[model samples]
Target: SQFTLYADTSSRRPGFSKAAKPDLAVPLYEKFMARCRERGFQVEHGEFGADMQVDSRNDGPVTILFDTEGNL
Candidate 1:
């Protein structure tokens, strides 16, 4: 449950100001994680604003992206 900032840009470079500020985002994220735990999930996560090295060896998994209108 790593909450990375949702950054986007019109051109080639990236812009990060679109993501929710930590002051607001962190509390909501914490609430969500708490709900998941309350539902008996064994959740593992990283720091909210820290760089982490994630290593995975699993086979390919399906990935999807969507906008607010639900179109990819």
Candidate 2:
């Protein structure tokens, strides 16, 4: 069985700041489901979105973790 994952750092909605924009939900959902099919796993999908508005902003790199079978 094989699986594929897709991620995007940009959003579908426009006019919002990159840091505050909602992500491309449709593409993300499609890719996730497709990967489940390729892996022969029963499709279980979850998504979370946020627009964090923090005072006194600090610049830093963003990191995401996709846990597959308990492996980082």
Candidate 3:
């Protein structure tokens, strides 16, 4: 089993006075869940504050930690 972990940060929102915080987790989470289901891997969601976690796979898990408070 090949597992992988990824993280991304962005400040891109259109039609705004300034760059806004990105919706960093949703896309990644959806894709990760779909892939996990397709590949038949046991996927789990971490606790509220946990950054990332993985179990029984060659590649790690995908985790996105958003700093919503840092938006400017």
Candidate 4:
């Protein structure tokens, strides 16, 4: 209820290009969210492909993704 999610829709597998099929990624993400929900993590998000400016001010180290994207 207090956390945020900033999921990235950009999917790039080792053998795939930037032009590879993204058709499965969305569903996979949905399933992942479903599992998370099953485990009781309330989920929220932003515009899937939109650029965002983070305004966090935490002292702990933060983990960024390979796409330099954020997810919460």
Candidate 5:
């Protein structure tokens, strides 16, 4: 999965100012990926700010979208 943290509000051009800073986000991303690794899934990822390209295939036609207001 490609986790691109984004801002809450919409705009023609996105500015991820509301996204978690790397100090916070990186550790969480690492922990999540580690859990996936523990589940026996081979995983590979790029550095925090690297440009990445993903080529993937979906076996099932399921789509879900979520939005958050930053209120727990």
Candidate 6:
């Protein structure tokens, strides 16, 4: 069995100049979801341009971060 998580985030919005950051990400996000579905991934996502909130808990007091800027 395999499991993975995905999130699409952005910080831009056009046309509706009064919009906020991360507003123009819906189209890109939808494409991602479609591709994942085609690849047989368990799909779970909110509607495009919808406000969302997420929470998480860790098992221990240690956390690690990865910077993939130039790893390729």
RMSD of 6: 9.6
lDDT of each: 0.71, 0.48, 0.50, 0.54, 0.72, 0.51
In terms of TM-score, how similar is model 3 to the real structure?
0.31
Count of backbone clashes for each model? 0, 0, 2, 1, 0, 0
Query: Candidate 2 on 1-72: residue-level lDDT in tens?
Result: 121233432444222233322357556666767988899988754434433444554467874544444443
Candidate 1 lDDT, 10-62, residue by residue in tens: 54555778888889988988888899999999777778877777786657686
In the range 23-70, model 6's lDDT, one tens digit per residue, is 445566667788999999998865555555656678898964433443
**For residues 1-72, could you state the per-residue lDDT of candidate 4 as single tens digits?**
222243334555322234323375556666777889899999775554455776767677886555624343
- Candidate 5: tens digits of C-alpha lDDT, residues 1-72: 365757553434556787888899889989989999999999898787677787867778885344344333
lDDT over C-alpha atoms for residue 64 of model 1:
33
The candidates, ranked best first by lDDT, are: 5, 1, 4, 6, 3, 2
Weakest lDDT window of 10 consecutive positions for candidate 2:
1-10
Model 4: worst 10 consecutive residues (lDDT sum): 13-22
Best by lDDT: 5
List the candidate 2 regions with Cα displacement exceeding 4 Å.
1-23, 44-72
Encode model 3's per-residue lDDT on 1-72: one tens digit a residue: 122233233443323334222365456666767799899887775442344555654465785455545664
* Candidate 6: segments with Cα more than 4 A from true spot: 1-24, 59-72
Residue-pair clashes, model 2:
0
- lDDT score at residue 63, model 5, on the 0-100 scale: 55
The global Cα lDDT (0 to 1) of model 4 is 0.54
Q: For candidate 5, what is the TM-score? A: 0.61
Q: Judge candidate 3 at residue 4 and give its lDDT.
A: 28
Which of the two candidates, 3 or 6, achieves a greater TM-score against the reference?
A: 6
Q: Candidate 4 or 6, higher lDDT?
A: 4
